[model samples]
Target: MREVRNKWVFKKVKVDVFRVVRRVEELMRELNDDMSVAGEQEVCSEGGGRWLRPEVGWVKLNVDAGVKEGWGLGIGAVCRDSEGAMLWGMTEHRCATLEPSMAEAEAILVYMNKARRRGCSRIVVESDCKVLIDALQLKTKGRSDFYLLLDDIYSICNDFEIVL
Candidate 1:
């Protein structure tokens, strides 16, 4: 009778432990879901909506950049018309590694230059990097490492009617 009682208690403890573990896993999943939803909402609000269509007679140039730890950086851009049709797209890999922000700045510079070479006069430049946009708009000449790149971008802006 004593042996049976001990076995029953052990089984009950094991089941309870598993139940607690299952609850923890469920909570973690819920937390991750909530975080992802929040992130999506933030992006939507910042981006002004999904797939922004450019104004009439203007081409939308969207640029993005990514950095790998040991590897260098990759930059890409897509130019689309008001009808949401892709006009041009390009991707370039930089052999020199850089910080994420610098990589983003480089992407804008490269894309704008390419567009200019392609004779795109009127463009709406779009980037997810709000900091870079704000800096460009405000003309903030800080002593950061991106200052030179920002200057170059401003200079490049002179070649076209650019709307950020």
Candidate 2:
């Protein structure tokens, strides 16, 4: 990571007509820094999950995992600062059935990507699923379909620190 004047600088490129995802990540990091430095209103916080605060202004992202037998799956995430204020959040519902681990992973990916777009950099993600956390920690390979999702997650990881 290249740091210029205490700000991370990233090259932005346009692919065809659409922009790559990392640009959003960079902007999100900037937004988070500005909000924290300016002491903006609270957006969200770690409700009741494990979190690791490695930096003074780093944001905490809390995600919850839910599974439905026939209906599919649902995941919710709330991004907050150390002050316990909400910054941004999302609740995703996937119609396709998925394993608990996959659901958890997808949820984190979703939340992380969203946070990146919002300019969040120093982030600690909190989730309720221990299995998912362990898998991410162990860096295990998943199924083929899951592999693609994991790839996206891995690509964005360069933008933020993920906490289990």
Candidate 3:
């Protein structure tokens, strides 16, 4: 019985690892593509406190993640130019139960991937989740389980100028 259980766990782990590898490959391909996706990438100049614009030639991407008990996670990103005008925006819903920090980090990775896919030149990313920011900035060790996401974020950052 114990052996059977171990085999089942191993199978699950293998499948999860495969999915992650496939995802990383997909992101790499997206980054290499030069064509930008057509649509709204920015927003108006109104924002609450804590919103700041990046320098000229650099766009600021603000991302947030929210999770509702029993409901799943929602993540979004908005890009603003030096004039505080939005250039584009995106939102995503993920169905998974992970730690808040992990969820936030995942959301950030999602948006970073999007920006890379769009062939952004330079970007400053803003996030309210300190844990994710700290991890991205290498200020904290972060949870080991989600280190893959951090690694992916770092790799994505290499494709262009990124400020966290």
Over 4 Å off, model 2: 1-54, 142-144
Model 1 clashing residue pairs (backbone): none
Give one digit per residue, the lDDT tens place, for model 1 in 46-126: 224665567778898999987776667889998977655567788887898888888889999999999999989899998
Number of the candidate with higher TM-score, 1 or 3: 1
Candidate 2: residue 45 lDDT (0-100)? 29
**What RMSD does model 1 have?**
16.0
lDDT order of candidates, top first: 1, 3, 2
| Higher-scoring candidate on TM-score, 1 or 2 | 1
TM-score of every candidate relative to the true structure: 0.69, 0.62, 0.67
Decreasing TM-score order of the candidates: 1, 3, 2
Q: What is the number of backbone collisions in each predicted candidate, taken in the order shown?
A: 0, 14, 6
Candidate 2: deviation at residue 120, Å? 0.3
* Residue range 37-140, candidate 3, lDDT tens digits: 32223322223243444777998888887776676887888776766555777777778787888788887788878887887879998888887888788834
